[model samples]
Target: MRLFLCEKPSQARDIAKALGVRGKGEGCLTGAGVTVTWCIGHLLETAPPDAYDPRYKQWRLEHLPIVPEQWRMQVKPKTASQFKAVKRLLGQASEVVIATDADREGEMIARELLDHCRYRGPIQRLWLSALDDASIQKALAALRPGASTFSLYHCALGRSRADWLIGMNLSRLFTLLGQRSGYQGVLPVGRVQTPTLRLVVDRDRSIEAFQPVAWWGIDVKLEAARQVFIAQWQAPKAACDEEGRCLQQPIAEAAKAKMASAPSAQVTDVRTERMKETAPLPFDLGTLQQLCSRKFGLGAQETLDIAQALYETYKAITYPRSDCGYLPMSQHAEAPAVLAGLKRADPALVPLFDHINPGRRSRAWNDAKVSAHHGIIPTTVAPNLDKLPPRHRQVYTLIRARYLAQFLLEHSYDRTRATFECAGETLLATGKQVIEPGWKRALPEALAAQPGREPAQPLPPLARRDQCPVRDVQLKNNWTQPPKPFTEGDLISAMKNVARLVEDPKLKQKLKETTGIGTEATRAGIIQGLLDRGYLTKAGKALAATPAGCSLVDAVPRAITDPGTTAIWEQALDMVQSGEMPLEEFLARQSAWMSKLVERCKGLNVTIEGQAKAPAWKKKRKPAGARRAPAGKGRKRTAPAE
Candidate 1:
């Protein structure tokens, strides 16, 4: 019998349906000589410190940095039954096919289960990008030997081990320290979470320290035949260089002062040009989260959850957890069909997609740009709206709308700018008028105006050298605002590792080569973990680090807090995936770094007094209903430290 192991039960059901398997039994579906079983997320997890040593269970500073000589794995208590079912199925089968998601984490989920279950047999890998019926059939027909997925497994294993080394060791160290300081809580820390928290804290610090300074600019307005025109200030011909950088600010200020002193101003020149803006690239996980946060007021984790549900439950979209914002070239042929599918489900988008021409030029659709998975788009399975929950339907609509818009014509608009001079002072204004609302008409909703902001008014047309009367003139004083706090949206954008923020070019380039701080799949979770541990909190859309969070980062050695450390590890992991670097080398480097960090943390003098209180995990638990005891009737009971 052939046994099929899938990442989750939903995927297994899909596979079974595709292969026409109908017989259902405990933990599996059987038919056509195939037994399909599934794992419920993670069946085996990294063993806790107590699994290494009983003494390690006690939260003592003496057991600081509980680095296991060799990591062990055990079935997670909640999923032990599922693991046993899969093990029994694997034992009875003549061969096994690994039907898991084609990604690093998914690969780890399958391999670890098999390793823990002690399954040894000829194995094959079912690799498919989408869960749609056609994609599943193709993958099954072209299944490759399981050995083909070894490199992927190696990369996944390395990632898990790296996270474990950092998460386990640091969580223990911090929790123990918090307990010693008379606080009760789990001082949760991880390789990615710590750095992510540092980002929020640092941004807050920058905003707090910012000091505003005043600056002035010359404006010009000209009148021609009852029409007004705006022109550039000219700036005494020497202040600005060829590239437009003001070589001397003082000279420019003097020039502005002189212009103000003059009685009348004259128009120097007028230039008008038309520019075209192509539609935005397709939605990747990061870009989609950013857009949803900015547009729908959705948090990063909320967006991820919505997108995941759209992908898995509704089957309305392809993979939601992708980094690349480009589709494969081969998918171009299927665009029309996919759009048609969406149109049948969403009639509102039909008009927007009617004029779509598949030959449009968009770098966002380039196949070469795609990595492990293509950008998120509607799957071949047309969304069954009747079956979708309200939230899933909304998210599915978002995916379908984006897919249709991608094939539509580019949005065209006329961008106009004018400069005017009056009383020797220069004034400038600009306006944008849509000439053609092509793909933009299909947008999910109209762009929302910011709070306290009025919609921009259109400017009237004017000619060069025209003279017009000035209705009013006034100076507007504006303070230099501090850096804005990071919303979940902004944090995700920053985490994309753009490197533009880093002043050093070398470090920036290295960051690009490493592909940002963490993979798209892990970034949101890292942020969420920080929040769950009280290292970060939400104030409206912005993320603010708690006092404990700030102090924990401040107390940690600089090496642990540096984003470059994560970047370097990412580079090494990439090399391992590509077969250019050995897993042993990467693991050795990680171990060395871990040893150094443990030593450094051991010597640090970190105190929590006056800082944020430790989490509840560190707090003592009181007896149930002890608080309800009659006053003065019973001895006061003290809660023991957790």
Candidate 2:
């Protein structure tokens, strides 16, 4: 008999239907000598330290670093019955098939059960990108040998064990030390959570310590041929800051005085250049989460949940947890079918039918760039939008728009910069005129605003050496504003772009190209865990570190809270996946490093600072139209864009 092990019941059911399996068994579906069983996530979990030796549960400092000689995994109490069913099938089956999500975690999910149940048989792997019948049939036609992906399992196992060692040892070590200092609350540390918490703590400290500096500027209104435009006065280098904000009030006053007296401004130079902007590639999970947070104020985990439903429940999209945004070249052939299905599902999309070209291929399709799975996109058969929930429909639209953008033309425009001179002071005017709104038309109304600089008002036609009559001149006082608190979207972007914070060039580039401290599938969970543990709090849309969270950063070694170090470990895990390093060697190095870090901090005095209160996000939002008046009115100038 052939046994198929799947990651979840929904996944198993989908596959069973595709394969014509109709008979149902206890915790499984069976037909025609083929049996399919599902796991509710992982059926077994790593045994805790106490499971190794009951004495370790008491939490004595003497048992500080609980290192197990022979690691053990026991069946979880909640899923033990399913485990038993799988065990029975594994014992009787002539061959086994791993039909799980196509990722490292899924590999571990199936591999761990095989190891635990002591199943030794010929194994084949099924890599499915979507639960839709068409996709399922495609995947079934190309079954890969189990060994082709076996390394992913070891890589995932290494990460799991490393996290266990770090979390189990360090959390106990700090909690005991905190107890010694009279703080009763348990201090939880993690491989990724600690660094994420530190990001908020560091940002809060910077905002608190920032000092605002007053600056000066002058805006002049000039008119030529009845067209008026604003020109900014630029101060001389000696009296200006690095960003050219006039630092000395006297200097700005002097320039404004001369410009006000002048009757006309001379245009020294006029330059215009054509520019084109390509549409962004479809989103990976990280980018999708960020956009959802920014546009809809959805939490990271909430976005992930909706995307997962779209992939599994509705069969409306491909995998939602993919790390790659580039599409596989093989998928481009299905574009016409996907487009037709989309139009059929939603009447609102009918007008765009003529504009979309299925033959046009964008830069997003590249076989070499795809890894395991391609971008999350609409499946060939689009589900009925009327039946889908509102949130699901909105998210689906966002994903669909990105894919549709690939078939549209590039957005093109003409950028113009005009330099002016007035009474020994330099003045500049910039503007842009849109020639075409290409891919932007594909965006839904809610996402049509786009993310970038505010479009400049188009300047009236001008030539070199033209004199424009000055209408008005005003000198302005502005203060430099501190960095704004991070929204969930901002935080997600920071976590993914953490490479900018690292000083090393090689590691910096590698991490920036790959991923940051966490995988696309786990970053949301890490953030949600931090919130549940009270290490972080949410105010409106902003994230702030709690008192306990701040104290934890100080108590632990800096390396533990460093995003760079954590990202390095993520890269090492990649090495394990590529078979560049043996799993045992990777774990050995991790164990040695963890043991040393634990030893160094064993004797430190620890005092955890505050009690954890309920997270602020759960509270009702205040009514709109409430605004606190500022002390005085002054235009604020922001820092230049990086």
Candidate 3:
């Protein structure tokens, strides 16, 4: 009998349906010589330190760096029944198929089980991105040889082991160190979560240290041929700051007075240019999370959940964990069916039918840019919008709109910039007029362009050197605002674009090419981990680092907190995936790195100045008149410091 292994129960059901498997069995679906089984995420996780040696169970400074000579995997007690059922099935199978999620983590889920069960049989791979019946059927007809993606297991194993070395060694090291500093909270750290925590800590520090700067500006309302418009006074370079904000209050006041006294101004230049803006690419998980956070005030994880429901539960969309916003060129052949289904999914999209031409293609359809999974899009299966929950409907609508946008014309507009000279002051006014609504027609008002800033109004027609009467002049005072605190959405975007945070050009390019810190599938969980550990707290939509969180970043070594370390790891993992670097080499380097961190930080004396006192464990106090060695080494040392 042939057996198919899947990542989740929902996924197993979808694949079983495609294979005409209707009989339900004890932990799987079975029919006519085929049995489908699934894993609830990973049935096996990397064994904790204590699993190797009972002595390691107690957290001690001496047990600082626990690098395992031989890694072990244990079946999770919560899902042990499912593992047994899978093992029994593997024992009876003549051939096996790995039908898990189409990514590195997904590969680990199935391969780990295969290794544990000691199954040796001919294997095939089912690379699926959508849960709809048609998509499942298509994937079944084009199965790949298991060898094509065999290296992916090594890459995932390398990543899992690397995370283990960092998380186990570093977390214990820092937590133990914190205990010495009178901090009782456990400082849990991970390869991705640490750098993510540092991002928030650094942002919080910047905000705490920010000092607002006061500035001034002048606005004049002018009337030309019974048409009125507003223009702002342009500050000279010497009187302005680097960002072009006027810094001289006196100069701004003089300009306001001079402009108020002037009766008329002559327009020096009126340049009007037409521009075309291509439709935005379809939704990648990161961009979708960012938009949902901004528009609907949804958390990153919440957005991912809604998207997952749309993909798996309702079959209204394709895969949600995609990092690429570009679609495969071959998939473009199904656009007509998808469009027809989209129109039937929601009645609101009916009016957009005329605007959407199935033949027209946008830049989103690119073969080379497509990743493991294409962008999130509507499937050919029509969904009943009324059957979906309110949030599901909202997310599905957004996904549908992006798909509809690909078939519409480009958004076109004419931009006008008018410059005027009045009472020795230079003033400028700008306006935009849309020539074609085009793809924008498919989007709701909330998803419209420039949703945050005030929209530009239509400008009155004026010729070059035309005279206009000054109606009124107003002096406006402005303050240079500090950066806004990070929202959950903002943190998601920051994680994906961490290259911008690095100062080194080579590292920046590497991060950019590798698609930033965490994978699209894991960033949401990373942020949630920080929140769960009390390292971060959410205020309204903004994420703020707590004292424990900030202190953890301060206490941790620079190598662990810096994003560059993770970027380098990602590069190595990529090399492993491509078979350029061996998994053994990657694991060896990570183990060496972990040992060095423990050695360097084991002897240091560190303390967080303000916090409740922890349990006494060799507390030491300085003598009143003792001379300090240096400011850096002046801290009173405490025994049992990690």
- Residue 352 C-alpha lDDT in model 3: 82
| Model 1 residue-pair collision total | 24
Candidate 3: residue pairs that collide:
none
**Whose TM-score is higher: candidate 2's or candidate 3's?**
3
For all predicted structures, in order, the TM-scores are 0.86, 0.93, 0.94
RMSD of 2: 8.2
Query: Candidate 3 lDDT (Cα, whole model)?
Result: 0.83
**Model 1 regions more than 4 Å off:** 61-65, 178-181, 215-267, 359-361, 384-394, 448-463, 501-507, 609-642
lDDT of each: 0.69, 0.83, 0.83
lDDT comparison, 1 vs 3, better candidate: 3
Q: Candidate 2 — what's its lDDT?
A: 0.83
Clashes of each: 24, 0, 0
Q: In candidate 1, what are the lDDT values of residues 408-439, reduced to their tens digit?
A: 67777667676666555555666556777777
**Could you tell me the lDDT of residue 490 within candidate 1?**
90
Write one digit per residue (lDDT tens) for candidate 2, span 431-485.
Answer: 8889987888899876866566565878999998899999999999999988888
